[model samples]
Target: MNEISSILAICGACISFYIGAGFATMQEVVQYEASYGSRFLIVILVAAAIYLYTNISFATNGNRLKLNRGGDIYGVYCGVFGEKIGKCAAMFFDYFSAFFCFMSFVVMCGGANSTLTQQWGAPFGVGAVTLTVLVVVTVVFGLQGIVNALSKIGPIIIAMILLVSVVTSVTGWGNFTGNLTKIDQGTYADVMQQVGGGNPLASGASYGGFVILWFAAFLSELGAKNKLKDVNIGMLLSAIFIFFAAGVCCVALIGHIDATAAADIPALVLAEQISPVVAVAFAIIICAGIYTSATPLLWTAVRKLADEGTVKYKAITVLAGAVGCGIACFVPYKELINVLYGLNGYLGFVLVFAMVAYDLRTKMSLKHGVENETAGIDR
Candidate 1:
């Protein structure tokens, strides 16, 4: 692929990967739109810009490290953090991925069940089984194959969302303009109240926590364990995609019923409103996203346990899948989201600190900063 295609592919992977079950519904926007309010877009823009910068920065260093897997980079950061603390952080982050992945798996089932139940009175058990099978097919193909397919499907997801939202609004005979005007009038404040946080000030600690969590969600750095093509474009494209996604979600929020539901899963809710076909499209999109979240989780866990043998490799993958599937069975959809978000927030705090320390060390050798050069292979 040429530079443009390469970058877009990277971009597709980075941005589309994050558009998981949570993002499509309303979790992402609620964090920004509800907690942050009209100011939410500002946070979305800023977060996208910062994430874009970090992605590029990470790629620049990761390629130099040529570390083969992301855990190596984590090791470097861990060393700088003091072996004890660093190892602890890595363990926390790595395992968290597994927990998050399983939770998402269950959610995909719930989402599919939700759609099926709403249509043709189909039993949820059948829908859940179907969704699980579909996910396994994609996983069996491994990350590269999925990425290849997503390079096409990712943008299509975005386009379809935009098309649905725009078409819906237009067909509304321009009530879109007036209907959206209600958004700024304080509907967000009410929604947060329903979600366990009364108001931003009252829930200051809680909402502040979410801002931090969003930062931690960016763990893979575009899955650039070693070298990826179109390094710079890949990341920038992700930023733009995120910004666009945030906008589409908000439009759905302002246009839909549960103006308060804006905080939930706006995409799926919006899809349900647009048409049954739209809902199915969103379901497929959610499944695709769950795959994205599932990866870093499985990769992190498997890396810790497996060595260079096929015996260990297959073992790790199965373990990861089993653990994740088990969690899906037990965890409630929204509770899982809250836990993931909170965990991301705390981890983000540490990562940002690492980012700062790394920057300082890079600028001053006296600080003993590692330039992300491959230090040594991990055992």
Candidate 2:
């Protein structure tokens, strides 16, 4: 086994895994892609670009700024907003991230369950329990374990997805040719064909363009220290892979069969056409992807609580997971996906705030330095 840095692995994992769960799922294929506001595959690719930027920046800031958690990261904002506003906003983003974290875990568990049972022979609940244990175990090791997975399994999974899809497409060249053409004519109704039926992603709200840009910045920040610089390049590469692999695969399955964009596991929908067995394997991989996606958010949220100096991590993790499981029991799994995604998107307002804070910090540092220089000259 070749040795690799854990941070790079995690960064690669999230880059490939974050938007990936939705990539082949009904919501991703039809809702986010064909049916949503922009209703374009281009939008997803662009979103991937935004994701790459923001996450990488955040991580870089975390490292360069000694930002272990939200406190260090938010210090820039505090310098700008005069503490009060900055603190409130920081608290909001952190808590909101945590809430979303809980929501993500639920969605992952549900998706994993549905995939295992529907695509594989395993019972749905079995998948849920298994994932629950996995999240707890992985996160207990904290960021290191997460980073290890990101660096190691992340690239392999990315390769697997591409390799499988490419093989499938080339082998079935006849289907690929026609399906590729059909995708050019995308629509809202086309997305409605999936499992979690929703009217596509739409919002009447606006936060100027900052929401979009801030998200872009945050995404770029997500890359771990080692692979941080590769974010933008990685996203562009990943986006092309995502669009062609996911979109084309969906079309192949429909093949003039008329399928909904809403199928929860659209990849599996496509995978089945190749082989029922392969489809099951695809579902397992997806389930693992969900686990990969959900755990980070969950760990971060609990870690935030610990960083506040308010709680024990073990206790906090248990409490947080318990709350998530409770909600999972009641909230319909499909709806949870929409709610969590929209909620995260709502953070656009604060993106500008985070940026301004950063700018102010730098300016103040420069100004203070120049004043000291002037004092020396006068003396």
Give candidate 2 misplaced runs (Cα > 4 Å). 1-10, 16-20, 24-26, 36-39, 167-257, 307-311, 349-353, 356-379
Best by TM-score: 1
Question: Given candidate 2, what's the lDDT at residue 150?
Answer: 49
> Could you estimate the TM-score for every candidate?
0.76, 0.73
Span of 10 residues, lowest total lDDT, candidate 2: 370-379
Residue 293 displacement in candidate 2 (angstroms)? 1.2
- Writing each residue's lDDT as its tens digit, candidate 1 over 157-221 gives 66665766665445443444454444456554444422223233322333333332222323333
Error of 1 at 30 (Å): 3.3
**What are the clashing pairs of model 1?**
25-265, 25-266, 26-264, 26-265, 26-266, 212-345, 213-344, 213-345
List lDDT for all candidates, in order. Answer: 0.52, 0.52
Residue 19 of model 2 has an lDDT of: 39
Tell me the deviation in Å of residue 39 in model 2.
Answer: 5.1
